[model samples]
Every structure is written in C-alpha cells, then in structure tokens.
Target: MKVAASMNRIDVNEVSKPEPDPVLVVERVSMKFNLGEQSVTAVDDVSFSVRPGEVFTVIGPSGCGKSTLFNIIGGLLGHYEGEVRIDGSKIAGSHESIGMVFQEESTFPWRNVIDNVAFPLELKGMGKSERLDRARHFIDMVGLSGFERHMPAQLSGGMRQRVAIARTLAYEPRILLMDEPFAALDEQTKLLLGEKVMEIQQRLKQTTLLITHNLSEAVQLSDRILIMTYRPGRVKRILDIKLDRPRTADVVGSEAFGRYVAEIWADLREEATRGMSDAESARR
Candidate 1:
C-alpha cells in the first residue's frame, strides 16, 4: 500500500484502534501505458500499506488510474515500477494469496451457484465431494446457502454478485481485491451488499482492498480511504473512517457518516473537475 503525500483529515492513530502489522505493502509503485503514439502515465509514486483484517479502499475520480493500480497489485499487469508484497515477499502475476473480483459480471452463465464457487477448488484438483463441501460454506457465508443449485440467470443482479463473491471466498485467498464490483448495482443493493461484505470480513478477518468511485460506498465499507489525483494518478490524500464495526443503516444515516462522505466528496469534486478539464483540453 502507498501513502499519500499527506492525509487530508483524521489523525488515524487517534481515531482508530491499533492494528496488527501490515499484510500488504505497495512501495513507490508507478506505471504508464501507451495511448496512441503517446505514452501516458497512469500511476505515479503510489505507496500505501494495508493491515491484516482491514478493509482499505481507493476512491478517486474516473481515470485516476485506480483500475491500473489495482491490476498491478493483483498481478494482472506488468512492467510497473516498485513492488507489491504480501507478508513481506514481492509478488508478481497472480499470486495464490491474492483473489480478485472484477467490475464486470464474472459469473459463468452455464454454471450454477455451487459449481461456480467450487470451480477454483476444482481447478486445484480437489475431489468433487470435498470441493462442493467447501463451496457450501462460502455460499452460506455470502448469504446464498440454498441457492446452490440455481443458475446464474435465475438469480437477480445482487444474487449473482453474491455468488461471485462466494466463489472468490471459497478459494480462501489471503487477500481479496474488489474492483468496483458493485458499480452496476442500484444504491440500495450496494448498501446491502456492503453490509454483507462487512459481516463477512468481521467473521473471517479478511484483508480486502477495494477500488471504487462511489464516495458513500467507500465511506460505508472502508476503514481507510486513499484518494488519487485526476490523471497520471498519484496518492493525493488518505483519510480514516472511525465508524463502528458491523456498520448498519443507522450508522450510514448518522451525522458522522455524512461528514465522512462530505469530506471525501469535497476532495473528489476538485480532482474530478480537473480530470474533466484535462479530457476537454486533450480533445482540442
């Protein structure tokens, strides 16, 4: 995890309880990509750390390289500067300790809930009875216990996403990465799913890294939030949220939550405006 040049608010140490040693570390991470004839920087000098059993999120305007940075951390993309380490060892290209959920709908249309969740175990050549048994636990964990036989098409959008999450959890990766995994969902659904995530995290002590543009979503889910600059993304600011655990509707509706959202929105408004202006200027 990369640190911002400075934090915008919250003396993190004062607001939050002490945490265990970091589980993930991003050091001086940077990257750029070819855009037509020009090479555009996507991420620059980003550094941060995520502690064990914490939900750490990156929230920024679109085109802030959140996706690019996520890809690099998940080992999906290469040729990046710096390194990403899990448990103190550098990782590259899809380490077993890392499990990722993409922004797109990732469920296999042909497979039912059980099979989908069991797929990773199956890939590892676990016996059918054993893999399905493991899958059932995660299915229950994600609140899809009885939907084991239902096909992806039979489920609603939220259910499908739940299945996807269960599938990832079934594999039991040391760290979970979610890239705008609920961007397609409605607000109510997002909030519900978020509670589900928090519940699961509390039960499992899962260490998660999330990339989202939604301010409220970040506020609801994150223990800490990292902001990136408009483009050629750099760590702009990091803010800590001290909301009580097992966050509920009451927590979301509280004045504290509203303040967190407003603070992030204020920073995001400026960055997003810059990104839009940059896009317009480039069009000229």
Candidate 2:
C-alpha cells in the first residue's frame, strides 16, 4: 500500500519505541460483559496510541466492539482488563481532557445554535458572555456562522452534527473521540462533514480517535487506521495513509486513495464474512 513518507508509520519497531510523549495511550485493553448467568467477551487485547494532533481511526466489522472500546476510552464504561491513559494519567472516569461526539443528534432541541455550542462552557462555569464568545468562534470555524440562532429542529442532519462538533471543541479537550458521528448522514453529506472535521482538526491540532466502518472515510481522514478482527475485537493491523493533508472530497477520485481503500477493504472482507458466519450459527 502507498504510505505517506512523512507520516509516522506504525511498524513493529515504532510500536516497540513509540513517540516520546503520545497524547493518548490505550494499552492491552480487554473488556467482557456478563448477561444473567452467561458472559461475553466484547474486546480482546486491543492496544494502540494516538500522538498529539493525529487523527487515529479504528475500523472493523459490526459487533466487533468498536463502540464498546470507545466507551472504555471515554471512561464511560470501566472495569476493563487493560489501561487507558491520557497525557500520562490513567482515565478513571469521564475526563476533562477527552470530548466525545456520538452518532445520534445530540443537539438540544430547545436551545439555539450558540446556546448548544456554549453548553460545555456553561458547565465549566464560564460567564455567559465569555462562553458565547468562544462558542461563536467555533461555530464560525465549523461553517455555521449564520446559524448561531437556529435551533436543532431548524438545521439539517449534517448541520446539527456541525453544531455538536462546535460545542465539543468549545471546551478545548486535548483528545476528541467520535463514534461514527457521520454514519447516519448521506454519503455526500458524510464526505463534506469529513472534510470539515479534518479542517477543524488541522486548525486545533487536537488528538482525535474516530471509530468508523466506512473504508473510504478511514482512508480519507486518518493518519493511521487500526483495523480490528471479527467479534471479540482485536487489532488486526494498523495501516498508514500516505495521502497529503488538506484533503477534500476530490481526494476520493485519486488513484492513491483508491489503493488505500482497497487494501483496507481486502483486510476487512474476510473478518466481515467470519463475523456474519458466527452470527448465523448463533441464530441457529
């Protein structure tokens, strides 16, 4: 696969001696769930690190515990076997340094755009005027400058997601965790929002970890993608993306982009088939 020369490619050696100071570290994390008298292993021995300002993505088949792993990292679900640390500190619960935007529309229907974006700041006890000022800046940054007064009901799906992003960034979290935030949107809208997200990441330089099933999205938005195996998720591979930055929708048409997408798809196809087979057998 075509790899970016300048990108910090994660090889066996690089994994042995990672960056001197990674912004986020997820080491040997494994999770299991108990249902009545039975138990289920959701994630199995997954480990990876995201560097400062890097957009790291995790992709895998359905039921591979992508969302579960994300929750563990966000400190929403605890009691996992391994450790998750941010800035060298273990994450015990919801951390101030981590912000999350989920797949569902999280915008408050009663609040206007500016109010929604400023909610995080409100929780932090910032004065209304100061919080609104910061909120407006992020709103403008996310291309929702004129929608500051619009309510969640007034905006489209993609627009509402933008509002969520602005709100999340207002708090200035060191790391951003997105759980398929654009999965519900149309392909065109998803691509547009992906570009917008990349622009925002470039501007803020915040370490971001996105869990997406879209191969194209992974290839387009990630500096490195961690592909997982079938159910009871594990790191299958971590592939480096070579495409140059400032990426837009047009990048999808490039030959290099296609190669990266194909490579990832090739890796995932087998795992997806296996996952489907397991599901079918369980149904029987």
Candidate 3:
C-alpha cells in the first residue's frame, strides 16, 4: 500500500505554511471494478488529505481515476479498499459531514431556487419558513438572491450550477467535495464561476477537495495540487501553490501563477500522452 507524503514540496513559488491536522484523510485507498470475466483497478493505493479551509485539488490525465477517487471520498462509492475519514470518524457510507457538487447541473428542474436550496434542510425537518430563510442566505452567498423564484430550467447553465452550489451550502457540511463542478461551461464562464466558488469558500472557510482537469483553474483556486499518474491513478506529485489568497480571475495573469501552471503542465504532459495511447488502444 502507498501513502502520500505529509509534506509537499513547493513548485515555482517557494513559500510554506504550517501544517495543521487534516479535516479529510484517505489512507491507502484503492478501488477495483469487475467486468465480465475481467477485472480492472481504477484507483491504486491513493492517499492524501485536505486541511481545514484550504482548497486541495486533484489533477491528472483523462483515464487517471481522478473521478473514481473523488467518488470514493464523497462516499458515493461504498465498496473500496483502504479507508476514508472525515473529522476523525471512518466513513462507511454517505456521512452528513461530507457534501458533493457534481459536474452535472444537479438542480431539480421542478424546484425553484429557494425550494431547491432548502431541500436538504427540509429533509432534516427544519420548518418551511426557517428553511427558506436559510436557503435564501446561501442563495445570496452564491450571488443568486434575485433568482429565488426561478426554476432550474429558467436559469442559464452557469446560473443553474450556482443554484446547485447554494443547495449544497444550505446543509452547512463540514467538508465539500466538488467533482469538475464547472467542467461543462466555456472558459470565460468557468473562470467567472470559479471566482464565485473562491468567494464563497473564503467566506465560509470551507475545506474543499476539488477534482479538475483545467490547470489554470487549479492554479488559481488551489492551495496545493496533487497530480496523479495515468491509469490506476496514484499520487505522482504534490505541489504547494504559494500564491496569495482571496484570489480572483485577474490573478491568472501574474508571473507566479503562470509559473505554477507551466510547472504542472510539464508534469502532466507525459502522463496525458500515455493516457491518450491507452484510450486509442481501448478503442481498437
């Protein structure tokens, strides 16, 4: 079994922060799937941790099991090797402390923004009026105060994603797991939404584990990034992004930011090539 290092080396920028105990921890996690008369390993001996109030990102090539590891951490996949923990307790299934925002627009088409954001609260037996009030605060946090009455179908893709985020925030989870939450949007929209996510993250000091393919987005939003190897993904490197916090879209232009991006891309290039080759072979 393999485990990621407790201390990550800095890349590009050479600053360090004191290490705190992890809010989320994965120990020697490995997941496998069985096909008809065949078996495949998706994630192999992966280990990492997310500190409180920091954005910890996972990045890798297409077939690198980033999503597989993410689902495992989210408790969406209950059967896997090794163990996962949040706030000290081991997870067997979906735990209330962990929340997920998927790549898909997850807002219910039938529910309006307030109703959608309040759904989780309602599930907890909070009164309708009180839940709506709580929902409104999260909706406002995502900058959707005026769209409280709008249904998912009535909003743009980005707006619907915002609604999904607000809905997750309504429950006030201790840890947030986002799997390519802004993946479907165009570049400009992704950047803008990323800014909104950063704003909400800073405000709430939410401990987040984000899975993304966009290096620029990772550089802009992450405090540290864990790069994975191709197929049967394992930790290849962990790069501490020593950029100033409370970041925005404008930060992408800085020399430090560009260096981080370049450094990560260099690390990913060969692994991505191997992934592409595997993809072609599988298609044959």
Compare the candidates by lDDT and give the number of the best one: 2
Query: How accurate locally is residue 50 in candidate 2, as Cα lDDT from 0 to 100?
Result: 89
Query: How close to the true structure is residue 280 of candidate 1, measured as C-alpha lDDT?
Result: 90
Model 2 CA deviation exceeding 4 Å by range? 1-17
Q: What is the Cα-based lDDT of residue 232 in candidate 2?
A: 83
Supply candidate 3's per-residue lDDT for 228. 89
Candidate models: Cα lDDT each: 0.87, 0.89, 0.86
Please rank every candidate by TM-score, starting with the best: 2, 3, 1
lDDT of 2 at 116: 97
Worst 10 residues of 2 by lDDT: 1-10
RMSD of 2: 2.2
Give the per-residue lDDT of model 3 (tens digit) for 1-284.
Answer: 01113234744212122236788878889998898888888898877778899999999988899999888888788789998877767888888988899998799998899999999999999998899899999999999989999888889999999999998989899888899999989999999999999999999999988998889999989999999888888888788888787899999989888878888888899999999998889899
Separately for all candidates shown, the number of backbone clashes (residues 3 or more apart, or on different chains) is: 9, 1, 0
TM-score of 3: 0.93
